[model samples]
Target: MDSVKLGLKENWKQFALLVIVNGFVGGMVGMERSIFPQFAEVEFGVASKTAILAFITAFGISKAVANYYTGKLANKFGRRTLLLFGWLLAIPVPFMLIYAPSWTFVIIANILLGLSQGLTWSSTVVMKIDLVGEKDRGFAMGLNEFAGYFAVGIVAFITGYVANSYGITPYPFYIGVFLSIVGFLLTLFWVKDTRDFVKKEGKNNKTVELKNVFLETTFKNKTLSSVTQAGLINNLNDGMIWGLLPMVLFSLNFDNENIGIITAIYPAVWGIGQLFTGKMSDHYSKKGMLFWGMLMQGIAILFIPYSSEFAVLAGLSAILGLGTALVYPTFLATIAQATSPQQRAESIGTFRLWRDLGYAFGAIISGVTADIFGVEYAILTIASLTIMSSLIIKFRMPVNIKTVRK
Candidate 1:
């Protein structure tokens, strides 16, 4: 334990490796993001919006369950074990996507993708937190999320372009095969468990461990629950974008390449903005970041429904991404600050359980609402819910504008 060092500079090599590994994780999601809805509508003849989005529901629910368990199981089985085991699930995904003759197989593939994401993404997150300790936690989260989401942005554009050039089936999905293999080999060969870092940090950590991690993270603690609800709302809106944005752009006559660029812009801005937002959290007020961030996202979502021009929509997406960037790292950093080292993993899992559920609820709600009320109404509904979430954070979470970080 005496040999353990706890700072980003000290763990740069491992941290860099984990960042690259997480990029692969986000790339997995990217492969499906920009084109799946189009694929369903075109290939499978599934025109019902709700039916097309069932894959996201499956992904959300499965990922939520896996996230909950990953936290409970992390310390017991070891992080590396959970990570390697997750890759096993990913190996079959691209093949499943490429060959599926029916919609059911696509749903099954997303289920696998969600589970693999839960385990692998959760492990990398926990491991990075374990590695960096206290000094640069927010920056570490920023870099971590940036790597993952930026990958999502990049892959989305590539696949969208590829799908535009070569008919959307075998070619775009080929990237998934390469990513899964590289991600797996990297984790198996180079990734190390962070249990030792946890042990080291725990020795000096004085924050009180929660009596019940789930209850407190979910509802009992005002500060934690505030952050938790904001996370759910963030992802909820994101799910809406994931499941519907392409369809909306198509309704306006934009092609796949354009839809891909518009879709990628939001996450690209989100990924890049976090590089600064994360560091800002360390120097500035987290509460302000959360409040304004959610507000910005809400405003952007509301505007999205009104935009018909390509540049206007793209600009709105960037604003939305920037808003999300403001809060994404802050959410994790706040969670880490509020909880003790002893139960951090479970607390994070509990928070993510509800957060990922937003994806399902968003997909289901938006899908059904779009089917019934129209796409505009569906967008309006999510945007309203997002604003309400921002208000919760503003009123419930305590203001901590003066806290300083080195």
Candidate 2:
């Protein structure tokens, strides 16, 4: 621990292991991405769109709150403790979902899931930043998100197939049970604490000039605030997709398997595309990448309801994924770059608090809109909101914002 070094190559073993752990963390949520909403409607007879999307609402709110605390606690307790404790919270989520007898039970399960995700995912993000230092922060973030979301896509695809075959109850959620145990064991035994690395980096670093971390990351600093809002709205539209995409296809007469395919494709492309886009942010202007990425996401989302053909919808979903790939890792990289090592975790937690809150907002807003005007109009409104977020990024963010580099 005393010989701690910074760089992905230096920490590749732990970095690789954390990536895998985060994948399982992602898989914990991915299992539901394709099946949960449909399960609510079909299994429990949930009739209201708001009621069907209640789980996402529960998840978003809990995760947002958890993200804020995970930061504060990680600094106090250590990242590994938070990571393990997060998995402990996750232990019951799968069984709750599998054996749930009421819609309320499902929502309860999501509350736990959100808490677990906030801690585990947030811990991994901080751990990776701790290990990689400043050199390839973008690439490191890209890898972290890629592993997590790709696993999301993979599990979503698998669960969709399972639900199509075994019904939504017992099989689809079995993935979560397996992931919860494996994520806990691997994180406990294999992953090491990276807080020392942060200490090491801080010793030799002259770059970071700290600010009021919460206020600056949340709203005070120009570039940080821009990234924060973009992250919020990015996930805002994503929450719309997570809660509504499968339902839209189902209403269009698409079967469960097909629904999974369409649903899986979006994050699949998003997960895989970040392989390059993350590195691109390291080299290119983050502002440009964010501007175009948000614009593309808005466009892709706007076209989803209008496209009746499977190919076209799939194409649009892929486009949406690509757009997200461009910005998702960039968001974290930029946030990490903006703050000092001491402040990084808290700042990240703040950014993620608002970002995950978009999930709640998207679910509630889309759910209410879907209930009132229908899903199509709800989606249209969400897309318009996304486009507006992009414009905010374009005009409000400083063109030449400085980021701390160690």
lDDT of 2 by residue, 1-406 (tens): 5678799999999999999999999998889999877898889989899988888989999999999999888878999999999999999998998788888988998999999999999999999999999899999999999999999999999999999998988988888889999999998888888889889887867656655778888788889999999999998899999999998898899988999999999999999999899999899999989999999999999998889899999999999999999999999998887777888899899999999999999999999999999999999999999999999999988776586564
lDDT to native, each model: 0.91, 0.91
**Candidate 2, position 116, lDDT:** 95
What pairs collide in candidate 1? none
What tens-digit string does per-residue lDDT give for candidate 1 at 1-406?
7888998999999999999999999999999989999899888999998999899999999998888899999999988999998888998999999999899999999999999999998899889999998778899999989999999999999999999999889999999999999999999999999999998988877787788999999998888899999989899999999999999999999999999999999999999999999998888889999999999999999988889999999999999999999999998888888887768899888888889988999999999999999989999999999999999999988886222222
Clashing pairs in 2: none
> What is the clash count for each candidate, in the order shown?
0, 0
How good is model 2 by TM-score? 0.98
What's every prediction's RMSD, in angstroms?
2.0, 1.3
**Per-model TM-score versus the true fold:** 0.98, 0.98
Count: clashes, candidate 1: 0
